[model samples]
Target: MTRQRVSLRQELPLLVWLVIVWGALWQDFSPGNLLFGALIAVVVARLLYLPPVELGGRFNVLRAIPFALGFLAKVVAASFQVLFLAVVRGPRVISAVVAVPLRSRSDLLVTATGHVISLIPGSVVVEVDRSTSTLYIHGINVRDADDADKLRKEVRETEAGLIRIMGTKAELSALNQEVGA
Candidate 1:
Protein backbone atom coordinates (compact mmCIF):
# COMPACT_ATOMS: atom_id res chain seq x y z
CA MET A 1 0.00 0.00 0.00
CA THR A 2 1.23 3.49 -0.83
CA ARG A 3 1.37 6.25 1.79
CA GLN A 4 -1.05 9.12 1.39
CA ARG A 5 0.44 12.58 0.96
CA VAL A 6 -0.41 15.07 3.70
CA SER A 7 -1.93 18.35 2.59
CA LEU A 8 -1.08 21.71 4.17
CA ARG A 9 -4.77 22.54 4.41
CA GLN A 10 -5.51 19.32 6.25
CA GLU A 11 -2.61 19.79 8.72
CA LEU A 12 -3.22 23.50 9.27
CA PRO A 13 -5.47 23.12 12.31
CA LEU A 14 -3.16 20.60 13.99
CA LEU A 15 -0.15 22.82 13.39
CA VAL A 16 -1.88 25.87 14.82
CA TRP A 17 -3.02 23.89 17.88
CA LEU A 18 0.47 22.58 18.53
CA VAL A 19 1.98 26.06 18.26
CA ILE A 20 -0.57 27.43 20.71
CA VAL A 21 0.20 24.60 23.13
CA TRP A 22 3.93 25.21 22.84
CA GLY A 23 3.60 28.95 23.44
CA ALA A 24 1.37 28.31 26.44
CA LEU A 25 3.89 25.86 27.86
CA TRP A 26 6.66 28.45 27.73
CA GLN A 27 4.41 31.20 29.13
CA ASP A 28 5.54 33.55 26.41
CA PHE A 29 3.78 34.93 23.35
CA SER A 30 6.82 36.70 21.94
CA PRO A 31 7.52 36.51 18.24
CA GLY A 32 10.65 34.41 18.88
CA ASN A 33 8.68 31.90 20.94
CA LEU A 34 5.95 31.79 18.30
CA LEU A 35 8.49 31.15 15.55
CA PHE A 36 10.16 28.38 17.58
CA GLY A 37 6.78 26.89 18.34
CA ALA A 38 5.87 26.91 14.66
CA LEU A 39 9.07 25.09 13.82
CA ILE A 40 8.42 22.48 16.50
CA ALA A 41 4.82 22.08 15.41
CA VAL A 42 5.94 21.52 11.82
CA VAL A 43 8.42 18.82 12.85
CA VAL A 44 5.91 17.10 15.12
CA ALA A 45 3.16 17.26 12.55
CA ARG A 46 5.41 15.64 10.00
CA LEU A 47 7.02 12.97 12.22
CA LEU A 48 4.10 12.02 14.43
CA TYR A 49 2.49 8.79 13.16
CA LEU A 50 -0.88 9.49 14.70
CA PRO A 51 -3.84 7.94 12.93
CA PRO A 52 -6.57 10.28 11.66
CA VAL A 53 -9.61 10.45 13.87
CA GLU A 54 -12.95 10.51 12.12
CA LEU A 55 -15.30 12.89 13.89
CA GLY A 56 -18.65 11.88 12.47
CA GLY A 57 -21.85 13.90 12.44
CA ARG A 58 -22.47 17.61 12.01
CA PHE A 59 -21.93 20.05 14.88
CA ASN A 60 -24.79 22.49 15.37
CA VAL A 61 -23.47 25.42 17.38
CA LEU A 62 -26.91 26.94 17.69
CA ARG A 63 -28.34 23.76 19.18
CA ALA A 64 -25.27 23.40 21.40
CA ILE A 65 -25.85 26.77 23.13
CA PRO A 66 -28.62 25.49 25.39
CA PHE A 67 -26.70 22.32 26.11
CA ALA A 68 -23.61 24.28 27.12
CA LEU A 69 -25.62 26.53 29.40
CA GLY A 70 -27.40 23.54 30.92
CA PHE A 71 -24.08 21.83 31.53
CA LEU A 72 -22.77 24.88 33.37
CA ALA A 73 -25.93 25.05 35.46
CA LYS A 74 -25.65 21.40 36.39
CA VAL A 75 -22.01 21.87 37.35
CA VAL A 76 -22.73 24.84 39.61
CA ALA A 77 -25.80 23.23 41.20
CA ALA A 78 -24.10 19.91 41.79
CA SER A 79 -21.08 21.68 43.25
CA PHE A 80 -23.22 23.42 45.87
CA GLN A 81 -25.14 20.25 46.61
CA VAL A 82 -21.96 18.28 47.11
CA LEU A 83 -20.55 21.02 49.28
CA PHE A 84 -23.68 21.07 51.44
CA LEU A 85 -23.70 17.33 51.79
CA ALA A 86 -20.02 17.04 52.58
CA VAL A 87 -19.62 20.06 54.83
CA VAL A 88 -22.99 20.83 56.41
CA ARG A 89 -24.21 17.27 56.85
CA GLY A 90 -21.08 15.24 56.86
CA PRO A 91 -21.06 11.39 57.18
CA ARG A 92 -24.77 10.95 56.54
CA VAL A 93 -24.43 11.03 52.74
CA ILE A 94 -25.76 8.11 50.78
CA SER A 95 -24.31 7.13 47.43
CA ALA A 96 -25.44 4.65 44.82
CA VAL A 97 -24.45 3.43 41.37
CA VAL A 98 -27.11 3.81 38.67
CA ALA A 99 -27.27 2.12 35.29
CA VAL A 100 -28.48 4.48 32.57
CA PRO A 101 -29.52 3.13 29.19
CA LEU A 102 -28.36 5.60 26.58
CA ARG A 103 -30.41 6.36 23.48
CA SER A 104 -27.56 7.05 21.04
CA ARG A 105 -25.46 4.07 19.98
CA SER A 106 -22.68 6.23 18.53
CA ASP A 107 -19.40 6.07 20.44
CA LEU A 108 -18.92 9.86 20.27
CA LEU A 109 -22.33 10.50 21.78
CA VAL A 110 -21.86 7.89 24.49
CA THR A 111 -18.39 9.15 25.44
CA ALA A 112 -19.46 12.80 25.42
CA THR A 113 -22.48 11.94 27.58
CA GLY A 114 -20.28 10.13 30.08
CA HIS A 115 -17.76 13.00 30.22
CA VAL A 116 -20.44 15.63 30.71
CA ILE A 117 -22.19 13.67 33.45
CA SER A 118 -18.91 12.99 35.21
CA LEU A 119 -18.02 16.70 35.11
CA ILE A 120 -20.77 17.45 37.59
CA PRO A 121 -19.58 17.17 41.18
CA GLY A 122 -22.31 14.93 42.59
CA SER A 123 -21.91 12.13 40.03
CA VAL A 124 -19.22 10.18 38.20
CA VAL A 125 -19.07 7.57 35.47
CA VAL A 126 -17.81 4.36 36.98
CA GLU A 127 -18.15 2.10 34.00
CA VAL A 128 -19.35 2.12 30.41
CA ASP A 129 -20.83 -0.87 28.62
CA ARG A 130 -20.41 -0.15 24.93
CA SER A 131 -22.15 -3.34 23.98
CA THR A 132 -25.35 -2.24 25.69
CA SER A 133 -24.82 1.51 25.37
CA THR A 134 -25.17 1.76 29.14
CA LEU A 135 -23.41 3.98 31.65
CA TYR A 136 -22.92 3.06 35.31
CA ILE A 137 -22.89 6.35 37.17
CA HIS A 138 -22.05 6.63 40.85
CA GLY A 139 -24.04 9.42 42.41
CA ILE A 140 -23.65 11.11 45.75
CA ASN A 141 -26.53 11.44 48.27
CA VAL A 142 -28.67 8.81 46.60
CA ARG A 143 -31.19 7.79 49.26
CA ASP A 144 -33.44 5.24 47.58
CA ALA A 145 -35.14 4.11 44.39
CA ASP A 146 -36.64 7.53 43.75
CA ASP A 147 -33.27 9.21 44.03
CA ALA A 148 -31.66 6.63 41.76
CA ASP A 149 -34.39 7.09 39.20
CA LYS A 150 -33.95 10.86 39.32
CA LEU A 151 -30.24 10.55 38.63
CA ARG A 152 -30.92 8.14 35.79
CA LYS A 153 -33.40 10.61 34.30
CA GLU A 154 -30.89 13.44 34.61
CA VAL A 155 -28.29 11.42 32.70
CA ARG A 156 -30.84 10.57 30.05
CA GLU A 157 -31.75 14.20 29.61
CA THR A 158 -28.11 15.20 29.30
CA GLU A 159 -27.57 12.48 26.73
CA ALA A 160 -30.57 13.72 24.78
CA GLY A 161 -29.22 17.24 24.76
CA LEU A 162 -25.80 16.06 23.56
CA ILE A 163 -27.42 14.03 20.81
CA ARG A 164 -29.26 17.08 19.56
CA ILE A 165 -26.07 19.11 19.37
CA MET A 166 -23.66 16.66 17.72
CA GLY A 167 -25.40 13.38 16.93
CA THR A 168 -26.17 12.17 13.41
CA LYS A 169 -29.66 12.40 11.88
CA ALA A 170 -30.07 8.64 12.34
CA GLU A 171 -29.24 8.92 16.05
CA LEU A 172 -31.67 11.78 16.41
CA SER A 173 -34.37 9.75 14.69
CA ALA A 174 -33.69 6.83 17.03
CA LEU A 175 -33.86 9.10 20.06
CA ASN A 176 -37.12 10.68 18.88
CA GLN A 177 -38.59 7.25 18.33
CA GLU A 178 -37.51 6.05 21.76
CA VAL A 179 -38.89 9.08 23.58
CA GLY A 180 -41.84 9.67 21.24
CA ALA A 181 -40.57 13.20 20.80
Candidate 2:
Protein backbone atom coordinates (compact mmCIF):
# COMPACT_ATOMS: atom_id res chain seq x y z
CA MET A 1 0.00 0.00 0.00
CA THR A 2 2.81 2.40 0.93
CA ARG A 3 4.75 1.60 -2.23
CA GLN A 4 1.66 2.13 -4.39
CA ARG A 5 1.08 5.52 -2.76
CA VAL A 6 4.63 6.65 -3.47
CA SER A 7 4.61 5.44 -7.05
CA LEU A 8 1.23 7.07 -7.69
CA ARG A 9 2.54 10.35 -6.34
CA GLN A 10 5.53 10.15 -8.70
CA GLU A 11 3.15 9.47 -11.60
CA LEU A 12 0.48 12.06 -10.95
CA PRO A 13 -0.02 12.66 -14.66
CA LEU A 14 -0.99 9.05 -15.14
CA LEU A 15 -3.54 9.32 -12.35
CA VAL A 16 -4.99 12.45 -13.92
CA TRP A 17 -5.17 10.73 -17.28
CA LEU A 18 -6.92 7.77 -15.69
CA VAL A 19 -9.46 10.03 -14.03
CA ILE A 20 -10.12 11.86 -17.29
CA VAL A 21 -10.59 8.60 -19.12
CA TRP A 22 -12.85 7.18 -16.40
CA GLY A 23 -15.00 10.28 -16.40
CA ALA A 24 -15.41 10.12 -20.16
CA LEU A 25 -16.29 6.45 -20.09
CA TRP A 26 -18.52 6.77 -17.03
CA GLN A 27 -20.73 9.27 -18.81
CA ASP A 28 -21.72 6.74 -21.43
CA PHE A 29 -20.34 3.95 -19.18
CA SER A 30 -20.62 0.65 -21.05
CA PRO A 31 -19.11 -2.04 -18.81
CA GLY A 32 -17.06 -3.67 -21.58
CA ASN A 33 -15.73 -0.38 -22.90
CA LEU A 34 -14.82 0.78 -19.38
CA LEU A 35 -12.75 -2.32 -18.67
CA PHE A 36 -11.00 -2.21 -22.04
CA GLY A 37 -10.23 1.50 -21.79
CA ALA A 38 -8.91 1.18 -18.24
CA LEU A 39 -6.68 -1.72 -19.24
CA ILE A 40 -5.30 0.13 -22.24
CA ALA A 41 -4.73 3.34 -20.33
CA VAL A 42 -2.85 1.56 -17.54
CA VAL A 43 -0.62 -0.21 -20.08
CA VAL A 44 0.07 3.00 -22.01
CA ALA A 45 0.78 4.99 -18.83
CA ARG A 46 3.21 2.37 -17.62
CA LEU A 47 5.00 2.34 -20.98
CA LEU A 48 5.19 6.13 -21.07
CA TYR A 49 6.77 6.28 -17.61
CA LEU A 50 9.22 3.46 -18.23
CA PRO A 51 11.00 5.01 -21.22
CA PRO A 52 14.60 6.08 -20.37
CA VAL A 53 14.36 9.12 -22.62
CA GLU A 54 12.78 11.83 -20.48
CA LEU A 55 10.04 13.50 -22.49
CA GLY A 56 9.34 16.26 -19.97
CA GLY A 57 11.27 19.52 -20.19
CA ARG A 58 10.96 23.28 -20.04
CA PHE A 59 10.87 23.77 -23.81
CA ASN A 60 8.94 25.88 -26.29
CA VAL A 61 6.53 23.73 -28.32
CA LEU A 62 5.34 26.89 -30.11
CA ARG A 63 8.70 27.24 -31.86
CA ALA A 64 8.11 23.90 -33.55
CA ILE A 65 4.94 25.22 -35.24
CA PRO A 66 6.90 27.57 -37.47
CA PHE A 67 9.43 24.89 -38.25
CA ALA A 68 6.62 22.56 -39.31
CA LEU A 69 5.07 25.31 -41.44
CA GLY A 70 8.38 26.07 -43.11
CA PHE A 71 8.90 22.38 -43.75
CA LEU A 72 5.44 22.13 -45.31
CA ALA A 73 6.22 25.05 -47.61
CA LYS A 74 9.47 23.46 -48.66
CA VAL A 75 7.67 20.19 -49.37
CA VAL A 76 5.12 21.94 -51.54
CA ALA A 77 7.77 23.84 -53.47
CA ALA A 78 9.79 20.68 -53.97
CA SER A 79 6.68 18.85 -55.20
CA PHE A 80 6.12 21.45 -57.91
CA GLN A 81 9.79 21.41 -58.85
CA VAL A 82 9.75 17.60 -59.15
CA LEU A 83 6.64 17.73 -61.31
CA PHE A 84 8.22 20.32 -63.58
CA LEU A 85 11.44 18.31 -63.87
CA ALA A 86 9.54 15.13 -64.65
CA VAL A 87 7.49 16.77 -67.38
CA VAL A 88 10.33 18.76 -68.95
CA ARG A 89 13.39 16.52 -68.53
CA GLY A 90 11.86 13.01 -68.63
CA PRO A 91 14.57 10.26 -68.66
CA ARG A 92 17.55 12.64 -68.42
CA VAL A 93 17.06 13.62 -64.75
CA ILE A 94 19.45 12.04 -62.26
CA SER A 95 18.51 10.58 -58.90
CA ALA A 96 20.97 9.45 -56.27
CA VAL A 97 21.25 8.61 -52.57
CA VAL A 98 23.46 11.04 -50.64
CA ALA A 99 24.64 10.48 -47.09
CA VAL A 100 23.92 13.28 -44.58
CA PRO A 101 25.58 13.81 -41.21
CA LEU A 102 23.25 14.55 -38.30
CA ARG A 103 24.33 16.67 -35.33
CA SER A 104 21.56 15.85 -32.81
CA ARG A 105 22.19 12.86 -30.54
CA SER A 106 18.65 12.15 -29.40
CA ASP A 107 16.79 9.23 -31.00
CA LEU A 108 13.69 11.41 -31.29
CA LEU A 109 15.65 14.06 -33.18
CA VAL A 110 17.13 11.50 -35.52
CA THR A 111 13.72 9.88 -36.14
CA ALA A 112 12.20 13.31 -36.74
CA THR A 113 14.96 14.04 -39.27
CA GLY A 114 14.20 10.87 -41.21
CA HIS A 115 10.43 11.45 -41.06
CA VAL A 116 10.73 15.05 -42.27
CA ILE A 117 12.96 14.11 -45.17
CA SER A 118 10.65 11.25 -46.14
CA LEU A 119 7.72 13.68 -46.13
CA ILE A 120 9.34 15.86 -48.78
CA PRO A 121 8.19 15.17 -52.34
CA GLY A 122 11.49 14.67 -54.18
CA SER A 123 13.38 13.21 -51.23
CA VAL A 124 13.19 10.00 -49.20
CA VAL A 125 15.23 8.59 -46.34
CA VAL A 126 16.72 5.54 -48.04
CA GLU A 127 18.87 4.43 -45.13
CA VAL A 128 19.83 5.46 -41.61
CA ASP A 129 22.93 4.35 -39.71
CA ARG A 130 22.10 5.11 -36.08
CA SER A 131 25.50 3.91 -34.95
CA THR A 132 27.27 6.54 -37.06
CA SER A 133 24.48 9.18 -36.97
CA THR A 134 24.16 9.41 -40.71
CA LEU A 135 21.16 9.42 -43.08
CA TYR A 136 21.20 8.31 -46.68
CA ILE A 137 18.53 10.17 -48.62
CA HIS A 138 17.41 9.58 -52.20
CA GLY A 139 17.10 12.83 -54.08
CA ILE A 140 15.18 13.01 -57.37
CA ASN A 141 16.53 15.28 -60.08
CA VAL A 142 19.84 15.65 -58.30
CA ARG A 143 21.58 17.04 -61.41
CA ASP A 144 25.12 16.85 -60.08
CA ALA A 145 27.30 17.05 -56.99
CA ASP A 146 26.36 20.70 -56.43
CA ASP A 147 22.63 19.96 -56.31
CA ALA A 148 23.18 17.06 -53.91
CA ASP A 149 25.33 19.26 -51.64
CA LYS A 150 22.70 22.02 -51.66
CA LEU A 151 19.96 19.56 -50.72
CA ARG A 152 22.07 18.16 -47.90
CA LYS A 153 22.74 21.67 -46.57
CA GLU A 154 19.07 22.59 -46.60
CA VAL A 155 18.06 19.35 -44.81
CA ARG A 156 20.77 19.85 -42.18
CA GLU A 157 19.80 23.47 -41.50
CA THR A 158 16.12 22.68 -41.10
CA GLU A 159 16.79 19.68 -38.86
CA ALA A 160 19.32 21.70 -36.79
CA GLY A 161 16.80 24.43 -36.02
CA LEU A 162 14.14 21.91 -35.05
CA ILE A 163 16.62 20.07 -32.86
CA ARG A 164 17.63 23.33 -31.15
CA ILE A 165 14.02 23.97 -30.25
CA MET A 166 13.21 20.39 -29.16
CA GLY A 167 16.44 19.25 -27.54
CA THR A 168 17.79 19.57 -23.97
CA LYS A 169 20.47 22.18 -23.20
CA ALA A 170 23.29 19.63 -23.25
CA GLU A 171 22.07 18.18 -26.54
CA LEU A 172 21.59 21.63 -28.09
CA SER A 173 25.13 22.66 -27.13
CA ALA A 174 26.64 19.48 -28.56
CA LEU A 175 24.58 19.79 -31.74
CA ASN A 176 25.62 23.43 -32.20
CA GLN A 177 29.28 22.53 -31.74
CA GLU A 178 29.00 19.68 -34.21
CA VAL A 179 27.37 21.92 -36.82
CA GLY A 180 30.02 24.58 -36.23
CA ALA A 181 32.92 22.15 -36.48
Candidate 3:
Protein backbone atom coordinates (compact mmCIF):
# COMPACT_ATOMS: atom_id res chain seq x y z
CA MET A 1 0.00 0.00 0.00
CA THR A 2 1.18 3.47 -0.89
CA ARG A 3 1.15 6.28 1.70
CA GLN A 4 -0.37 9.57 0.70
CA ARG A 5 1.99 12.54 1.09
CA VAL A 6 0.53 15.63 2.74
CA SER A 7 1.96 18.97 1.65
CA LEU A 8 3.46 21.59 3.96
CA ARG A 9 0.66 23.99 3.05
CA GLN A 10 -1.89 21.40 4.09
CA GLU A 11 -0.15 20.69 7.40
CA LEU A 12 0.64 24.29 8.33
CA PRO A 13 -2.77 25.13 9.79
CA LEU A 14 -2.87 21.88 11.74
CA LEU A 15 0.60 22.51 13.08
CA VAL A 16 -0.25 26.04 14.16
CA TRP A 17 -3.50 24.95 15.79
CA LEU A 18 -1.76 22.13 17.66
CA VAL A 19 0.88 24.52 18.96
CA ILE A 20 -1.77 26.93 20.11
CA VAL A 21 -3.66 24.16 21.84
CA TRP A 22 -0.51 22.93 23.52
CA GLY A 23 0.30 26.44 24.74
CA ALA A 24 -3.22 26.84 26.09
CA LEU A 25 -3.09 23.51 27.88
CA TRP A 26 0.15 24.43 29.63
CA GLN A 27 -1.08 27.99 30.30
CA ASP A 28 2.23 29.24 29.02
CA PHE A 29 2.80 31.70 26.17
CA SER A 30 6.53 32.10 26.59
CA PRO A 31 8.91 31.83 23.66
CA GLY A 32 10.39 28.59 25.04
CA ASN A 33 6.98 27.04 25.48
CA LEU A 34 5.92 28.07 21.98
CA LEU A 35 9.10 26.68 20.47
CA PHE A 36 8.72 23.39 22.31
CA GLY A 37 5.05 23.22 21.34
CA ALA A 38 5.99 23.77 17.71
CA LEU A 39 8.46 20.91 17.87
CA ILE A 40 5.89 18.63 19.50
CA ALA A 41 3.25 19.63 16.95
CA VAL A 42 5.58 18.84 14.06
CA VAL A 43 6.45 15.45 15.51
CA VAL A 44 2.81 14.57 16.16
CA ALA A 45 1.71 15.71 12.73
CA ARG A 46 4.38 13.63 11.08
CA LEU A 47 3.86 10.47 13.15
CA LEU A 48 0.04 10.40 13.40
CA TYR A 49 -1.79 8.91 10.44
CA LEU A 50 -5.11 10.68 10.44
CA PRO A 51 -7.76 10.94 7.81
CA PRO A 52 -7.55 14.04 5.65
CA VAL A 53 -10.52 16.36 6.01
CA GLU A 54 -11.46 17.94 2.71
CA LEU A 55 -12.63 21.44 3.46
CA GLY A 56 -14.07 22.03 0.01
CA GLY A 57 -16.08 25.15 0.55
CA ARG A 58 -15.89 28.89 0.25
CA PHE A 59 -15.58 30.40 3.72
CA ASN A 60 -17.22 33.79 4.20
CA VAL A 61 -15.90 35.56 7.28
CA LEU A 62 -18.64 38.18 7.02
CA ARG A 63 -21.31 35.47 7.25
CA ALA A 64 -19.42 33.83 10.13
CA ILE A 65 -19.98 36.92 12.33
CA PRO A 66 -23.74 36.45 12.39
CA PHE A 67 -23.34 32.70 12.84
CA ALA A 68 -21.12 33.24 15.86
CA LEU A 69 -23.55 35.77 17.32
CA GLY A 70 -26.49 33.46 16.73
CA PHE A 71 -24.64 30.54 18.30
CA LEU A 72 -23.85 32.65 21.37
CA ALA A 73 -27.47 33.71 21.63
CA LYS A 74 -28.60 30.12 21.42
CA VAL A 75 -26.14 29.11 24.13
CA VAL A 76 -27.47 31.78 26.48
CA ALA A 77 -31.09 30.97 25.73
CA ALA A 78 -30.57 27.24 26.03
CA SER A 79 -28.73 27.72 29.33
CA PHE A 80 -31.68 29.60 30.76
CA GLN A 81 -34.16 27.10 29.35
CA VAL A 82 -32.25 24.15 30.77
CA LEU A 83 -31.83 25.84 34.14
CA PHE A 84 -35.51 26.66 34.36
CA LEU A 85 -36.47 23.12 33.56
CA ALA A 86 -34.00 21.47 35.93
CA VAL A 87 -34.35 23.86 38.88
CA VAL A 88 -37.90 25.17 38.66
CA ARG A 89 -39.78 22.19 37.19
CA GLY A 90 -37.42 19.40 38.27
CA PRO A 91 -38.95 15.96 37.72
CA ARG A 92 -41.70 17.21 35.42
CA VAL A 93 -39.28 17.98 32.62
CA ILE A 94 -39.72 15.73 29.59
CA SER A 95 -37.01 14.58 27.20
CA ALA A 96 -37.17 13.05 23.73
CA VAL A 97 -34.88 11.78 21.03
CA VAL A 98 -35.48 13.68 17.82
CA ALA A 99 -34.05 12.87 14.42
CA VAL A 100 -32.92 15.85 12.37
CA PRO A 101 -32.47 15.30 8.66
CA LEU A 102 -29.49 17.08 7.17
CA ARG A 103 -29.55 19.02 3.92
CA SER A 104 -25.80 19.10 3.30
CA ARG A 105 -23.91 15.96 2.36
CA SER A 106 -20.57 17.45 3.33
CA ASP A 107 -18.87 15.66 6.23
CA LEU A 108 -17.51 18.94 7.60
CA LEU A 109 -20.95 20.50 7.77
CA VAL A 110 -22.42 17.47 9.46
CA THR A 111 -19.61 17.26 12.01
CA ALA A 112 -19.73 20.99 12.70
CA THR A 113 -23.49 20.95 13.13
CA GLY A 114 -23.25 18.05 15.57
CA HIS A 115 -20.62 19.85 17.63
CA VAL A 116 -22.67 23.06 17.65
CA ILE A 117 -25.84 21.30 18.72
CA SER A 118 -24.06 19.33 21.43
CA LEU A 119 -22.55 22.55 22.76
CA ILE A 120 -26.01 23.95 23.42
CA PRO A 121 -27.36 23.03 26.87
CA GLY A 122 -30.81 21.71 26.01
CA SER A 123 -29.75 19.35 23.23
CA VAL A 124 -27.08 16.73 22.72
CA VAL A 125 -26.28 14.59 19.70
CA VAL A 126 -26.78 10.95 20.67
CA GLU A 127 -26.05 9.32 17.34
CA VAL A 128 -25.36 10.11 13.74
CA ASP A 129 -26.59 8.08 10.76
CA ARG A 130 -24.12 8.95 8.02
CA SER A 131 -25.98 6.68 5.62
CA THR A 132 -29.02 8.97 5.70
CA SER A 133 -27.24 12.04 7.01
CA THR A 134 -29.52 12.16 10.07
CA LEU A 135 -28.67 13.21 13.61
CA TYR A 136 -30.44 11.71 16.61
CA ILE A 137 -30.47 14.46 19.19
CA HIS A 138 -31.57 14.10 22.76
CA GLY A 139 -33.59 17.20 23.56
CA ILE A 140 -34.50 18.30 27.05
CA ASN A 141 -38.07 19.21 27.95
CA VAL A 142 -39.60 18.12 24.68
CA ARG A 143 -43.20 17.71 25.91
CA ASP A 144 -45.12 17.44 22.68
CA ALA A 145 -44.97 17.27 18.90
CA ASP A 146 -44.82 21.08 18.68
CA ASP A 147 -41.77 21.10 20.95
CA ALA A 148 -40.04 18.44 18.84
CA ASP A 149 -40.83 20.28 15.64
CA LYS A 150 -39.51 23.52 17.09
CA LEU A 151 -36.27 21.82 18.12
CA ARG A 152 -35.84 20.35 14.64
CA LYS A 153 -36.51 23.74 13.06
CA GLU A 154 -33.95 25.41 15.31
CA VAL A 155 -31.31 22.86 14.32
CA ARG A 156 -32.15 23.31 10.64
CA GLU A 157 -31.85 27.08 10.97
CA THR A 158 -28.48 26.70 12.63
CA GLU A 159 -27.37 24.42 9.79
CA ALA A 160 -28.64 26.96 7.25
CA GLY A 161 -26.48 29.62 8.87
CA LEU A 162 -23.45 27.30 8.87
CA ILE A 163 -24.03 26.52 5.20
CA ARG A 164 -24.01 30.23 4.44
CA ILE A 165 -20.66 30.60 6.19
CA MET A 166 -18.73 27.55 4.89
CA GLY A 167 -20.74 25.45 2.49
CA THR A 168 -20.25 24.63 -1.19
CA LYS A 169 -22.64 25.80 -3.89
CA ALA A 170 -24.13 22.33 -4.18
CA GLU A 171 -24.84 22.22 -0.43
CA LEU A 172 -26.42 25.66 -0.61
CA SER A 173 -28.63 24.57 -3.49
CA ALA A 174 -29.62 21.46 -1.58
CA LEU A 175 -30.46 23.60 1.44
CA ASN A 176 -32.62 25.82 -0.74
CA GLN A 177 -34.46 22.81 -2.11
CA GLU A 178 -34.93 21.39 1.39
CA VAL A 179 -36.29 24.72 2.58
CA GLY A 180 -38.57 25.06 -0.42
CA ALA A 181 -39.80 21.52 0.02
**Top-lDDT candidate index:** 3
- In each prediction, how many residue pairs overlap at the backbone (N, C-alpha, C within less than 3 A)? 0, 0, 0
Give candidate 3 regions above 4 Å deviation: 23-36, 176-181
Q: In model 2, what is the error at residue 55, expressed in angstroms?
A: 3.6
Global Cα RMSD, each model: 3.4, 6.1, 2.5
Let me know the TM-score candidate 1 reaches against the reference structure: 0.77
At residue 178, candidate 3 shows an lDDT of 75
Q: How would you order the candidates by TM-score, starting with the best?
A: 3, 1, 2
Error of 2 at 144 (Å): 1.3
The TM-score values for the models, in the order shown, are 0.77, 0.69, 0.85
Model 1 Cα lDDT, one tens digit per residue, 83-151: 788798798778999999998777878999999999876689999999999999999888899999999
Q: What tens-digit string does per-residue lDDT give for candidate 3 at 59-107?
A: 8899999889878988898888887887998988889999999887789
What are the Cα lDDT values of the candidates? 0.84, 0.75, 0.87
Model 1, 111: alpha-carbon shift in Å? 1.8
Residue 9 accuracy (lDDT) in model 3: 72
What is candidate 2's TM-score against the reference? Answer: 0.69
